[model samples]
Target: MTITLHHLRYSRSTRIIWLLEELDIGYSIVEHHRDETTNRSQDDLFAIHPLGKAPAVDVDGRVMMESGAIIEYLIETHGAGKLGVAPGEAERSAYLEWMQFTEGTLAMPVLLTMLGPRFGGLDKLPLLQGFVGGEVTKLLDYVDAHLEGREFLLESGFTGADINMEYLLELINLTGMLDQRPNAKSYLERLMARDAYKRAIEIGGPLVKLPG
Candidate 1:
């Protein structure tokens, strides 16, 4: 059965779209348009998942929420070991750590940094924003150094870990944080150079928007 991906434009669901393209598996996309004003997903999304979030994938008969969880499930079910590290294998801990880390650790400052201006109230305190910016730089530095001599996150080559972590890097690039970190910027370039990434972007529609 072809899986159904509920994709929200300008959202992190692009990760799942890219993963499906990389897996070269058959699936269908259900595009959900975001509110042009607020840039939020439609309330109709709640019919699929309570959170009304993007990337609520329909796997056969199951509805999966969360981009990372959907990526994990797809890789495990269809990737046939090409894109995921098994639980007991070497680098499994790192794999799992990074899989969770993208959303758990890295996303906070990345989103906070972007949303600070939108959310306002923090604009007056450049010091506070500067502090958050420092944390963002720290996170990018760690990722850049780690990716210095490697093409993929794991020694095993590209895995779901890359799929999970890459969207955050895309966000970082959008914020222009990548300019200072050549390695991280190059990492985005490398990942985007893939035919799958390009196809996914085409399939999901362009993510680029007018800068805020």
Candidate 2:
């Protein structure tokens, strides 16, 4: 099957590029850059998906959105003895939990921490920054605790869950809260050391390091 990824520069879509490389599949990447000042996805993305989001892929003829969903789809379609744990495996539940947790649980705080400072009046409020910063730090601690003594989330080697998680942790790290969590820091370092991840960077561009 043919796969074409509609990628946004310096966004979560880069995680998909990493996965595609790990899957060892042949797929084309179509890059969409954010406006330099506005830092918004180009209007062209709306033509691909109604929500106009990145990490949208054209799989054969169907258009798919959401980074988590796309990762699962690729794993189901292309991952066998690689990148994912098949159904009925004991690790499957943990794998699913982490995949969902990355976007569902972790992403919310990161979003708030980022957007809270950028919105007009809120930027002037120290209270807003303290509340959001505290929340992000707590969540980072929870994740770092989960990562202790493990190379991957599910304990079945590096699966798609790592791909889902590393992006969020990297974003959290940029806040400087990451250095406090040693396990979390090393976990990210390990993922980046992968050649697939490096190659994905070459194709999709680097992930965004600073919070907006």
Candidate 3:
């Protein structure tokens, strides 16, 4: 099947790119920018996704949006019997758990904390920022504690869960929100060691500027 990923570099879309590379699936990418003026896409990504979100995928001819949904679809269709755990396997349960945790819980709080500063002034934003940041940190602490003495989030080896979590963890680090957690730091390092992630970085290099 021919897959087309509509993505923006360095955004949550990177998770999709990493997943594709990990699965070794052949796909094409359509790169676009989030408009500086509106802080959204200049193009009609919303025509494909009502929210104009990145990381939307066109599988064959059908379009799918939302990163978590996109990842689940890819894994279920192209990744089953291969990169992911078999159906009804215990690892499959664990995989779904981590994937939902990463996107639904972990990423939501972190993203809210990030937006607090933009929507409210720094001085006034501390309440929401602290609330969201505290929740995200708590979740990260749980994950960090769980990951201790283990190599991956689920199963005996890497899976889509790790790919999902790694990007969120990196976002936390980039925001200077995770420095106090040593296990998270270590886990982030291990994630960076993956060749697929390195390739994603190379592909994304010129599309978005990394913060120093």
Q: Write the per-residue lDDT of candidate 2 for residues 114-148, one digit (tens) a residue.
A: 56656764447778767777878888999889889
The most accurate candidate by lDDT is 2
> In terms of TM-score, how similar is model 2 to the real structure?
0.92
Clashes of 2: 0
Ordered by TM-score, highest first, the candidates read 1, 2, 3
lDDT, each prediction: 0.84, 0.86, 0.77
- Candidate 2, residue 136: the lDDT equals 84
Name every residue pair that clashes in candidate 2. none
Worst 10 residues of 3 by lDDT: 203-212
Write down the TM-score of every candidate.
0.93, 0.92, 0.88
Which candidate do you rate higher for lDDT, 2 or 3?
Answer: 2
Per-residue alpha-carbon lDDT of model 3 for 1-212, expressed as tens digits? 89998877558788888889888889998886777666677556777777788878999899888777787789888885655766688787887788788877787887776556567644576776677767987887898888778878864787777877887777668776667777778888988888988888777643234547
CA lDDT for candidate 1: 0.84
Provide C-alpha RMSD values for all models, in order.
1.8, 2.2, 2.3
Candidate 1 vs candidate 2: the lDDT winner is: 2
Clashes in model 1: which pairs? none
lDDT for 127 (candidate 2): 85
Q: How far does residue 7 in candidate 1 sit from its true spot (Å)?
A: 0.5
